[model samples]
Target: MSNVSYYTAEGLKKLKEELNQLRDVERPLASQAIAEARDKGDLSENAEYDAAKEAQGLLELKIAKLEETLANARLIDESQLDTSKVLVLSTVKLRNKQNGMEMKYTLVAESEADLKSGKISVTSPIGKGLLGKKVGDTASISVPNGTLKFEILEITRN
Candidate 1:
């Protein structure tokens, strides 16, 4: 069974763009490569043709995966999001209780997770730990290294 995927508006847009590129550009290019390889030599022992066919198969697989993701995606309503507690699409500011270090992160879908941009996957340990916690609440999360505690400082939609 295919699990339904929840995506922010931006994430859904990105998936649509990728699907367009695959259908219009990559698919045609793959077909052209296969045709060119087929013209090179006999099909029985043609190495180029075999390689091109393999590449085309991989391209089709990618296209299929993207299509499936798009079909299963549900856009999240950004306007309806509440900042009362940590939730998906919420930007949370936290202070480490053990080391007094401050950090901020936005909880997002797995596909939208980019640590460099401070977007964390909702399924991630830290994000999971912070979920449903209000300001002034302390969360104890288990990390790969060890257990760490964080105090929720603030929550915002942005």
Candidate 2:
């Protein structure tokens, strides 16, 4: 099954850059380390050769996984996004019903989520709860502690 993921233009660019770094820079470094270790002595008795081979295997696995992710990634056009309701890339302003505290968050792909920057994964509990919500809509989300209610104050596309 293809696990397709959506990303903004910037997010997609970052993913591509990371894949390139892994393939171009790290791959060659791993190969060089393995070559140096192989030239030392017998393969069975050499611990350095064994470790280098293991490291190279892990690096190759990482590269393959990244390539697969890039293949399944779809770039989202911010200009074409609808602001009528909450969806991916929507910047939502929420108000906590219990404490009247207000906060803002941008719904993004899982790989692009950064809580410090107010970007949240769409699959997260709060993000799922807020999905498709409109202004003045209340979202009752179940968390580890308890159910927290949030009032959707506004939704906009940035």
Candidate 3:
């Protein structure tokens, strides 16, 4: 079964662009490398040829995975998202219960997760715990060290 993921227009476009780059540019480069390596010497004794073949195999696997991901991706309409609670694509303002520190994060797909830009994957520990939480709701998220509590201050569609 294919796992379907939802993405905003920008994210979907980025995925398509990456898929195209892999197929059009990376695939040819892998093939060319294989050809060059094959011309070097005996197939059984050539380390370069073996390495090139392994690289090509890995490249093909990556391409296949990307293709499958693109096939299962769906574009999300941001305008239709609800702002009543923390949800996928919702920009949530949270206050760290223990430290009194405030931070904001946009819940996004796994592929689009970027901590620096405050976009987190919905599957992440904090994001998972924040799902369906309304304003003022406190979510206790478990991390590698310990459980941290975050109070949802606000939720908005961005």
Best by TM-score: 2
Better of 2 and 3 by TM-score: 2
Ordered list by lDDT, greatest first:
2, 1, 3
Q: Distance (Å) between predicted and true CA of 8, model 1?
A: 1.8
Q: Which stretches of candidate 1 lie over 4 Å from their true place?
A: none
- TM-scores for every predicted model: 0.94, 0.97, 0.94
Residue 6 Cα positional deviation in candidate 2, in Å, after optimal superposition: 0.6
> What C-alpha lDDT values do all the predictions have?
0.92, 0.94, 0.92
Cα lDDT tens digits, model 1, 16-107, are: 99889988998899899889988987999999889889988998899899999988888888789888998899999999999999999999
List model 3 lDDT by residue over 23-52, tens digit each: 899889888888998898888998988888
| Candidate 2: residue 86 Cα off by (Å) | 0.6
Clashes of 2: 0
lDDT of 2 at 142: 99
Worst 10 residues of 2 by lDDT: 76-85
Candidate 1, position 47, lDDT: 91
Per-candidate Cα RMSD to the true structure, in Å, reads 1.2, 0.8, 1.2
